[model samples]
Target: MRYTSEHKQATRQRIIEAAGRRFKQDGIDGSGVATLMKDAGLTNGAFYAHFASKDDLVANVVADQLREQRASFDSTPSGRAGVEEFVRRYLSVEHRDSPESGCPSAALLDEIVRCTQATKEAFTDGALGVIDEISAGLAPGDPQSVRAQVIAAFALMIGTLQLARALADQQLADQILEQGVQNTLALLPAEDRG
Candidate 1:
């Protein structure tokens, strides 16, 4: 039986969503095409029907996940309000433990650097969008200063989560998360405080 166009689209979407979650949780190298297809409730033979290759799927998934991240930030309040909220949620223990729902930077930074040029470009575009939003929230200042701060904030966020996850001791994890949050919050401009 031949599948309808809608059915094929839905199947393809399912595969993309599954791949996004797996890629975030397991990294690009960790998720194989066979396992990804199986996880999506489809067989290996069906994989090529939707995606030309794993790289195609990976690029699409990266773009999709980045778009989701951008949407999340956009929905939040603008200016300092959004930054504070973002810092609070991003540095939480919950965010550290939940790789599937967390930022892709912390989950797949290494793999992203190694992906195809298309995938790298998608990641870069997504990251820049997020940084732009954050930069907009900063106080009026030199563009260079704002850019530097934005980079620092991004690094702090990803590094904190990474360290929290790596630490075997629960107390240490909590310490890393809390201290990271405090430090990040401290970096915000005094005028931005609310």
Candidate 2:
């Protein structure tokens, strides 16, 4: 039985969503195609029907995850308040504890740096879109001027979350998250801190 285009698209989306969660939880290299398929409630053979290769799926997942992250940013009030909210949420205990549902950059940046060219390009494009969204909120007057600052702040946020998640000490981890939020917020200009 042939599936309709919509069915195919929906199935593809399901696979991407499942893969995104698995990849974030269990790095891209750690997640086998069979496991990813199983996560999506499909057989290993069904993988090729949706993706040319695992690399292809990785690229798709990265793009999809980043788009979801971007949407969260879009939902916030557009200005310093939005950036503040973003920093707080990003460095929170909830986000730190939930790698599968949290920011892709925080969960997968290390792996992303080693992915295939296509996957890297997908990450680059998606990351740029996310950066642009945050930059606009940081500097509605001239986002370009604060683009570097935004990028630095975002990197700090990603790194801080990663470190917090890696620590065996719960108290240190919580401290990291608190300090991460403050340090990230400091990157913003005083004028934009409103």
Residue 163 displacement (Å), model 2: 0.5
RMSD of 1: 2.8
Q: Across residues 44-109, which tens digit of lDDT does each residue of candidate 2 receive?
A: 988999899998999999999999999889899878887899889999999999999999998999
What's the lDDT for residue 152 in model 2?
Answer: 92
Give me the candidate number with maximum TM-score.
2
lDDT of 2 at 87: 89
In model 1, which range of ten residues has the least summed lDDT?
136-145
Q: What's the C-alpha lDDT at position 72 in model 2?
A: 89
Q: Model 1 over residues 73-137: C-alpha lDDT tens digits?
A: 87777667778888889989889889987788888887888889999998889888877767766
Residue runs of model 1 more than 4 Å from their true location after superposition: 1-7, 138-145, 192-194
